[model samples]
Target: MKILLIDNASLTPVNSALCCEPKTGEFAKELQALGNEVTMYGQIVESENIHAFNIQENGINVVGHHRRKLKIFNYILLYLLIIPQIFKSDFIYIFYPSAFKYISILCFIFNKPYGLYVRGEMGLKNGVSSFIYKKAYKVFTVTDYFTTLINSLSKSNIAETIRPMINLNEKDIMPVNKKNISGIFKVLFLARLEEDKGVKEILYAIYKLKKMDYNLKLILVGDGGYKKEAMHIIDKLDISDFVELKGAIYDIDKVKNMYLDSNVYILPTYHEGFPRTLYEAMIFGTPIITTFVGGIPYLMRDKFNCVQIKVKSVESIVNALIYSINNHEKMLDYAKNAQTTVKPIINSTRLSHAEALHNAIHNI
Candidate 1:
């Protein structure tokens, strides 16, 4: 089978180099390994019109197309180049709906089947998403929570929840040692520093904790559109010393260390589509404190594996944190169970996701 994969979020000429969407690239490698000839089309760096390279080990050919920045001529040329590729390919796998827009028309004209993979919450009910999802042979989702929503928005019941590809190996896993619940509790908040990601809510929770004179350190990682505002909140509250805002660390080892050094991981995000960070925290045996949004509820239990908090609720965040601090032993239990629960999914590597894609194509 010849598969044409469109993942604009990934770096072009895909290799072992790390990028924002490494797992998506790894999945492409896995598809090639599954005996499918895959040509991954992604955005090219500036000044490069188009380039193609091969990952010899995986037998995957990666093509980098010029990234158009709101230019009509560029879009016209891109469509001309991509339509022929669609005619030649046996199947199409598009990561985001935006990318789907580029190929859906060609696929329709050629009478070819394509799979739509929804990575995030499609916030608005737009015609493009509705039409492509409805026309696609199948819709793959990251979480079960979005299954119903996608069906309603797309007006199609072809949506199925599939596991996300996370880069986790045995080396990244920390040694399971005896639980130590005492000392200055290290609470980690790692995600985009955005309003919807609950950065302000995290700050408010920390402020409430500080008022009670709780001995805890909050480490905020990742940079985004709300960094300055988040910084303002921290300074206004005069809790800068208690909180450390380490803007986006790109090193994978550094990220793993952050998880290892922290006693708990808190993601008070307002929305998510089965975030990979939860899997990372769980694999490292860090207890999770997150909101009941997106596919999070499907991945975890309210009080069993990890404590669930209410979305956009600072009081809920504070209460969950207090519960974690007061009942350290119980938190450790959650951490241990979380690691155990996530093992099967994370350890399987590309087999699970690849098989689902393969079956979706063959059945359709």
Candidate 2:
């Protein structure tokens, strides 16, 4: 089977492999591993169009266009370049909702069978989106919460749940013994520094914690558009001394070490379709302090594997942190339960995606 995979997020061509967002590039390779000819199309966020032409990166044929200052022109050229591949593909798998709005119409016009892989919260935008979703051959969403959202939009319950992002193997990773680091508590926030991701709330919570003289430090990871807002909040709150923004760490081992070293992993996200961070935190046996949003509630229980807090509630976040800090032994129990429970549940991986695509193609 020939597959045309499209995603909205850009990937940088570093050396011979595409750098950043390992999920998208890795999924393409997995599809190719399934014996399907795959052509992936995405934008490059870099300033220079280094690999403008179609190039083979990491054994998969990837065509990544560097978007110049004129964004519309980049999309136009991308559309023109991938049109032939879209026409030839046996099946199309769409990732990241932004592309679904425009690409689905082309699939419909060509009478091509395509599937939409919805990973997070998104709106229908317009009726055309609803129409395209309703007519889709298959719809794959990250969680049941997102499935319900998509079903409501399409006015049909055709969407199915699949966890195609299990990146941790228990045998390979040695869970961090946070007990080794005593006295000072370390909280890790590994996500885009976007405000909607509860960045502001977390910062405020940290400010309040520092005011109470709780010996602590926050390691903020990842880079995003809300970086300025986050810095502003940190500046205003006067919590700069307690917080450190590590930007984007591409090294997987370094990220794992952070998770292992930290006492708690916190991601008070507003919207999600089952973030891989939760699993990574669990696998590393890091106590989790996250909000009850999106597919998160479905994955974890309050006081079970994580301390669930209300979104945008600084008090709740602070209280959750206090609870983790005061009740250290219980927190370790939660981490242990999380580590054991999460391992059995996250059975889906890149291979699961390949099997699904293969089945979807064969069934058609």
Top lDDT hit: 2
- Superposition TM-score, candidate 1 onto the true structure: 0.76
lDDT of each: 0.75, 0.77
Which lDDT tens digits does candidate 1 get at residues 268-339? 988777888898898788889998776788779977889999988999999999998898888888888887
For model 2, name the residue pairs that clash: none
Model 2 quality (TM-score): 0.84
lDDT tens string, model 2, 140-221?
8777777776789888877877654655565644554456546678999998777789998999999999999999999998
- Candidate 1 residue pairs in backbone clash: none
lDDT of 2 at 82: 70
- What are the TM-scores, per candidate, against the unseen true structure? 0.76, 0.84
- Model 2 residue 165 distance off true place after TM-score fit, in angstroms: 1.3
